[model samples]
Target chain A: MTGDGKFNIASEKHGESTVLRPEGDVDMSRSSTLRSALREALGDKPSRLVVDLAKVEYMDSSGLATLVEAARNARTQKVPLVLCGLTTKVRAVFEIARLHQFFEIADTASAAIEG
Target chain B: MADTKPHVYLELRSDPVYLSGARQLIASVAQRLGFDEMACSQIALAVDEALCNIIRHGYDRATDRPIWLSVWPGRKDGQDPGMLVVIEDEARQIDPTIIRGRELDDVRPGGLGVHIIKEVMDEVEYEAREPAGMRLTLYKRLVQKDDSQDADQAGASPAGSADQGRVSNDG
Candidate 1:
């Protein structure tokens, strides 16, 4: 969140799920903020936690690590952590790392929440 | 290999705070050299991961230590053309042969740095500095775009081409 001026985060409750929309590059400098946001989203114990990365232009391993860490915690808490709206660049990163199968990816935030 | 020494060199302290500046520098250089957005992002991510490892493993998160980064444009020598990045740190020499990214199937956080660097960069090499420290070299081949895009890009006004530039600063 501190790295790029375009970075922004907004959270909202959608039915049985909580959605956290992050806009901007998710790198080492901003990954901690993402982690904290994830923690905050999970604190309420929603049935599903959705992260909308529609505006995320870039994501590094740190961002991926943060997601994985949060996903592990979510699993323990019985909350499904869903990620959606991955840009081509972000998707390529997941593919190269061979981590696309580890996550529950959706095409949209609404779909993530619905599923 | 066309005398492709670094045209830009940056010296940074081994601190986490400098990571943002380092990423920005890589992104700028990649963009200036005509890398697409995706390519630029990948290059930035690779360099960022490299720096993170140097700060964490090499210097033990010691913010006062020195880490050097150099960037150079690779020439078209019947190979993929792109940029080369070198990162040098004064941390204990690491065995490049033993460095491995844990299997992706392991499914965990915190160990993805090495994997990300190796995955994104076309070529990765490591060398132990004499006596102490290490140097890591990463190469990313630029993807050639359609000629129309290049022509459109060429229409822009030009700043005098700098053959090489060195920037020494405390980060």
Candidate 2:
């Protein structure tokens, strides 16, 4: 699904983990796409989920809620979900909303994947 | 079709419904113009926040006066593609100085409008119009076709081009 004009999810079977790269504005409008991507990344079983937000220009409460929900779901299943490469503006939304404790945020995708 | 003037205006009664409808009008105008996705989203959010503030604070929602809204596609420079969003309300005059942005940490319901407007637009100004009312003028310069098209070509970018967006919740 296309929303907010920019989002990409490419699945790679790296033996265990899957990565989802999200770009563009993530607001109420783009939450569905984000949820779908997260679901697809997790699949039926459990695995490491890495969501990269290096190119995200904007995000709102709805977007933050989506991430919080995804993180909770991953926790229930004992799967590792890491968010990487967040832009300052997007980070500010999460920070201002006091939602930083929701997910494992890594400084870089490589670090998230390696860890 | 009638040869009507391009400008559109609406009077917002000191009612919740009127404020909401005014917000929708801004969204509709931005949508109809084929505005870049980010610009439309920004305006919609800003308009919603603005209208809520007007109804909740400016008009007191219990007053008899009406709020007024004017929407038109305008540019400061003839060569530039831009938009002018004007919201006028026949409520008590507001102190422009009081319009100072509130801290995000306040987390209160009343002040988010200022921050939303600041974030959404490149320029925003509030004024106390004569005859006892308030006027808010918002300006946004559209990232037109050529520049946005180029951004789309380069890589994953902000609402520069590919104007058609995927998912947007009305809220």
Candidate 3:
């Protein structure tokens, strides 16, 4: 992900892990892009998915809601999903929504992918 | 009508895609006004909420009227980049009495827009324009804090007067 709000997905299959970097404002307008990327990363029945948000410059409530919904969906499917590298601003959003406790949060991609 | 104009002016249709474009413009112009990223982000949030109200309830997805959004950046009262955002739309005439902000304990998915808008702006004003329409004016200090202190210390109101708010009939 970059400050320009463009994120990339670099998947690795070392043992069991998927990484997707999302940049830009993931509001109602660009939420579909994130959802599409997650769908591709999840692929089969259920797999562990790790999202990196270091490059995200802006994220509104709609964007936060999408991530929360995705987390719920992954849980229902028994797939482990983790979000890593959240900026302070992004982290504050999760706190405001009280969603920080609902999913696994990590400081780095390695932590999420390896955990 | 305030004769002064914003450094940048844009009119957006009542569409979701245009919301993102409006936010992007706010960020770019806000930054140039010497506003920190957080202050700019707060303004963007306020703008989004205002637009949301116009989309869902105001127009009801039935009418084809355009929303007029004007962003003003100036050094009023010697404060750097004091911004005034005026949003005028011919959507729905909202009654202030029924538009009370939802509480945090209420916890609804859709009704928080007004709450967020009021909380983020330094000063908020609403008026009924001539003919048939509404005008929502939001003012914010780019650098300095208002009399009530900072955003974190802003108080929520049962009647929505705990903060600097004004509603008038600008006939």
Candidate No. with top lDDT: 1
lDDT of 2 at A111: 90
Q: Candidate 2, B146: how far from true, in Å? A: 3.5
- CAPRI verdict (incorrect, acceptable, medium, high) for model 3: incorrect
* Full-model lDDT for every candidate: 0.79, 0.64, 0.67
TM-score (all chains, Cα) for each model: 0.81, 0.52, 0.71
TM-score of chain B of 1: 0.79
| Per-model TM-score (chain A alone) | 0.94, 0.87, 0.84
lDDT of 3 by residue, A26-50 (tens): 7656766777666766765435788
- Residue B121's lDDT within candidate 1 is 73
Reported per model, the fraction of native interface contacts reproduced equals 0.71, 0.00, 0.12
Q: Cα-based RMSD of the predictions, in order?
A: 8.0, 10.7, 7.2
Error of 2 at A21 (Å): 27
CAPRI quality of model 2: incorrect
- Model 1 earns a TM-score of 0.81
Candidate 2 lDDT by residue in tens digits, B1-171: 222233677775565434335545776777665564555766766665566567667766564667676666654334344567777877678678778656655433234446657666666889988877888888666665456556466673342122222222342
The ten-residue window of minimal lDDT in model 3 chain B covers B162-171
DockQ of each: 0.39, 0.05, 0.18
DockQ of model 2, rounded to 2 decimals: 0.05
Task: Supply the global lDDT for candidate 2.
Answer: 0.64
